[model samples]
Target: MTRRHFRLLIPVFLVAILGGVVWFQLRSPSAETIAAWVDQAEIALSNQQWKESERLAQLIADSGDREAAQLIAGETAYFEGNLESAFQTLGQIPLESRWRPRASLLAGYAAFRLQQPYLAEQLLTEAIESYPKEVDAFRVLSVIHYDQGNLRVAIEDLQQVATLAPEDARPWRQLGLIHRDFERFPEAEQAYAQAVQRKLPPVLEAEVRQEWADVLVRLARHPEAEAILDAIPPEVPMTAERMTTALAIAQVTQSPEQLDAQLAQAVKQFPRHAPILRANGVRALQRNDPESAVKWLKTATQVDPYDYRNYYELAQAYQRANNATAAKEAESEVKRLQALLTRLTELSEAAMDQPWDAAVRRELATLCRSLGKMELAKQWEIAASRCEQAR
Candidate 1:
C-alpha cells in the first residue's frame, strides 16, 4: 500500500518480464540453427542412423521447421516400409523448395514399391532431371521398363545404372534374370558370369550360380551346368529353383533309376513347390501314367494357379486319362491365362508410355480384377481417375 512498496513491485514486474523474454529467446532457436539441425537430420538419414534422424525430426518440428520435419519423417516411413505414408509426406514438400529433389526421389521409389508404376515413372523422371547421377532412380526405372516388357529400354536404363555404379553386382544379376526369363540363354550366361566376377555375397552367389546352371541346362551345356552346381557349397539350402535346376541336369546325365530317386527326394524335400510337382507330372506323362500325371499336375495347378504351364500340362494329363470335361476346362484356363498375359503385356507397355491414358488404366484394372489381383485392380482404378484428371 505504501508508494515505496509499489515502486519496488514495479521493478520486480519489469525484471519478471525481462526474464520471461530471455527464456523465450533461449528456447526458440534461430533460423540458422534450425537449418543446421535440418542438415544434421539429412546427414543422419544418409548414414541410415534412423533413430537419430527421428530425434532430429521431432526437434526440427518443435523449432517450426515443418518442411524439414516432413522430409525426415518421409524418409523414416520409407525405410520402415510404410510406403504410402512416405509418398504422401514427401510429396507435400513444395516443388520449388531446395529439398524437393530428395523428396521426389524417395517418393518416386515409394510409388514404385507400391506398384504405382505410372506415378513412379513421373516422379522418378522429375528426380532424374534434378539429379542425373542418382543410380537408384535409374535402377527402379529399369525395373518399371522391364514390367512394361520394354526390354531394350530397360536394358538401356540398367546400362546407365551400371555406368554410374560399376562395382555394384546387382545390375548384372538383374540383367541375367531378365535374359533368363526371356530365354536368351547365352546372354543370361554372360551376365551371370559378370555377376560372379563381381564377388557377390555367399547367398546371392549361390542363387546366381543356380540360375546360371539353369541357363546352361537350357543351352544343353550339361557338363558346365553340373560343374556350376557342384561348385555351390553343401551348406547352402536347396531352394525350389535350385532343386529344379539340379533335376534338369540329372535328367540329362543320370540313369533312369538314379533320376527316379532324385525325383522322389526332390518331392520329399520340397513337397509344396509347384515346379517340383509339375516336374513330377511331366515325368509321369512321359512314362504313360496318366492317373499319376493328373494327380501331380492338379496339385501343381493348385499350388500356383497363375502359372499357365501347370494348366497346360494338366490338360494333357486329363486328356490322356479320358477326363474330357476336366481336360477342356484346363485347356480353357490355359488359353485364358495366355491371352491375359499377352494383353497385359501390351497394355502395360502402353500405360508405361502414356501415363495420362485413362482408358489404358481402366483396361488394366479390369484385367487385374479377372486375375484375382484385387489390390492391384483397386490401385489401377484409382490411377485411372488420376489419369483422367491429368488429361
Candidate 2:
C-alpha cells in the first residue's frame, strides 16, 4: 500500500530472480562436461561400481548419448539379477553397433536364465558367429547342448573352447566330465590328463585327479587308480563318496590285513555305515569265520534294512554256522526280495538282448548279487564292462 514498502519488495524480487538464473546455468552442463561424465561412467563400469555406474549412465542417456548408457544399464541389470530387464535392454542395442556382440551374449545369458533355451541358442549362436573367439559364448552353448543330451555336440563345443583358450584348464576338465558321464573312460582319462598337465588351481586339480582315478578304476587299472587315490592331499576333507571309492580301491589292491585296518578306521568314523559293515561281513566269511560274519551281517542289516544283499549274506552266514532256523528265516527274506526283483529281472533280460545296454546290465548285476547268485552277477558285470568299452 505504501511506495517505500513496494520499492523494498521489488529489490528482493530482483535478487531472487538473479539467483534462479545462476542456478539454471549451473544445472545445464556444457557438452565437454557431459563427455567427462560419460568417461567417468565407463571407468565406474570397469571398476564394477554398479550403482554409481548406473546413475552416471542414466545421466549420459539424459544428456543424449543412449547407446553406451543402455549397454551399461543392461549389464548392470544383469549383475543385479534382473534377467528380464537385462534381456529387454540388451536386445534394444542396434545389430550393426560394435556393442551388439556383447549385447547378444548378455541377452543370450538372460534368456538361458529365463528358461528360453531356443532364444538363448539363437542369440548365443549369433554372438559366437560375430565374435568367434568369445570363449564364454562357446562355454554357455556347450552347457546348453549338454543339458539337451547332445553329448557329442557338447564335446565339440568344449573342444573349440579349449582350442580358443589353451591355457585355461576348465574346458578340458568339463570335457572330462562329459566323457566320464558317457562311460568313455579312455577319452575321459585323456581329458583329465590334459587338465592336470595344465596345472589347475588346487581345488580343481584335486577334483580332476579324483575323476581321473575313477576312470582308471573303471578301466580295471586298479594299481594306477590306487596310486592316484593315495596321492590326494590329506588336507582335502574326505566326502562319503570319496570314502566309498577309497574302500573299493583298497578292497582291490590291499591285503586282508590292510583291508581290515581300513575297514576298522572307516567304521570308527562312520559307525552306521552299512557298506563298511557289509564289507566286514564279507571279509569274515572269506576268512572262514562264520560267527563273526553273522555278527557283522546282522549289524549291516540293521543299518540298511532295505538292502537285500545284507539279508542274503546273513543267510549264508547262518548256514555256515549251522543255525538252521536262522538260516531259514533269512532265506525267506531273500525269497520275498527276489519276488520284488522279478519285474526288474524281466526288464534286464529284455535289455540283455539289446546291444550295449550297460545301465540295464549293471542294474541286473546288482540285483543278482542280492539274490546270492555271484556267478550270474559276475557275468552281468562283465557284460556291462564290455558295453562301457563299446561306448
Candidate 3:
C-alpha cells in the first residue's frame, strides 16, 4: 500500500495493455490483406496453379475466412481430380455464405464425376435454384441425364446451357457427341457445324473440325468432309482416330495415287497402327498383289486381332492368294470377333440404362481389355470404381 508499490503496478498495467494491442494486431489480418490474398488465390486458380492456390487458401483460412478458403480448396482439389475431397470441402460451405452457389455447383460436378448421378442431380437442381443462369451446372446436368439414358432431358439441359452461353462452343460440341453416339449422323453434323462456327481454342477447333469431318463422312458428304479436313492446320498432332478418319475420307474421295500417298504417310507416321496397316493391305489386294496384301493383312491382324474388319480383309487376301484353308480359318475368326463386337455394343447400351450397376461397368472394362482398347478399359475400370463408391 505504499506510494512506490502503486507506481510499479501502474507501469505493469500499461505494459500488459500494450502487449494485448500488439497480440491482437498480429492475430487478425486486415480486410484489405484478406481481399488481396483472395485475389491472388483466384488468379492462381485461373492459371491452373493448384498448389499455389491451396497454399493461399490455407493462409486465408488461418485469417478466419473459412468459406472463401473452403471454396478455393475445393476448386483446387476438383481441378486436380481429387473429386472426393472436393465434394466434402465444398459441401461444408453453408448455404447463406457468399461462396455457396459456386461451392454447390462444384460439389454437384464432383458428385457427378464420382458416379452419384441421383445425388448430383439433386445438388445441381439446388444450385440452379440459387444461380438460375449457371451454365456449368446445366452442362453437367446434361451429362448426368445423358449417362442415365434420359436423352430428351439431356438435350433440353444442353439447350439451356447453349442459350445461357451463346458464345461458347463446348455445349454444341457436347450435343454433337450425344447425337453421334446414338448414330444420328445428320443431327451430329448439324451440332458439330454449330460448334465449329463459334469461338474455340486452336487445338479444340481442330478437334471439332475433325469430328465434323467424321460426321460428314458418315453422311456421305465426301467432298465437304475433304474440304474440312484440308482446312485443318498441318501442325496439329494426328491421333489414331484422326488418322483413321483421314484414311476413310481418302479411300472414298481420293484418286488411287493420292490414296496410296496418304496411306504411305499414315503408315510411316504410325508404323504399328492397325487401321493403316489394314488399309495398306486392302489397297494391295485392289492392285492384285496378293503376296504384299497377305503380308500387310497378317501384320494388321497381329497388331489388333480384335478388329473383325482386319480379319475380314485377311480372309479376302487369303482367297486371292488361293489359300482356301487359310481363308476359311480367317472367315471363322471374323465371325467370332463380330460376335464379340456385337456383345460389346449390347453391354454398352445396358450400362447406359443401368448407371448404378458396377457389374456392367466391370464387364465393359474386361471386354475392352480383351478387344485391345487399353485406354477405354482403364476408363471403364475407373467408372466401375466410381459406381461402387456411389453405391
lDDT of 2: 0.80
Candidate 3 lDDT, tens digit per residue, 157-275?
A: 98899899998888899889888988899989999999988988878888888899999999889889989878888888777778878998988988999999989999999999998
Candidate lDDT scores, in order, read: 0.87, 0.80, 0.86
Residue pairs of candidate 3 with colliding backbone atoms: none
Residue 273 displacement in candidate 1 (angstroms)? 1.4
Model 2 per-residue lDDT tens digits across residues 194-288: 98888676666777788888888899888988787677788877655556567778889999899889888887877788877887898899899
Give the lDDT of residue 129 in candidate 3.
83
- Which one wins by TM-score: 1 or 2? 1
Better model by TM-score: candidate 2 vs candidate 3: 3
Clashing pairs in 1: none
Q: In TM-score terms, which candidate is top?
A: 3
- Give TM-scores for every candidate, taking all chains together and pairing residue i with residue i: 0.62, 0.58, 0.69
Evaluate model 2: give its TM-score: 0.58
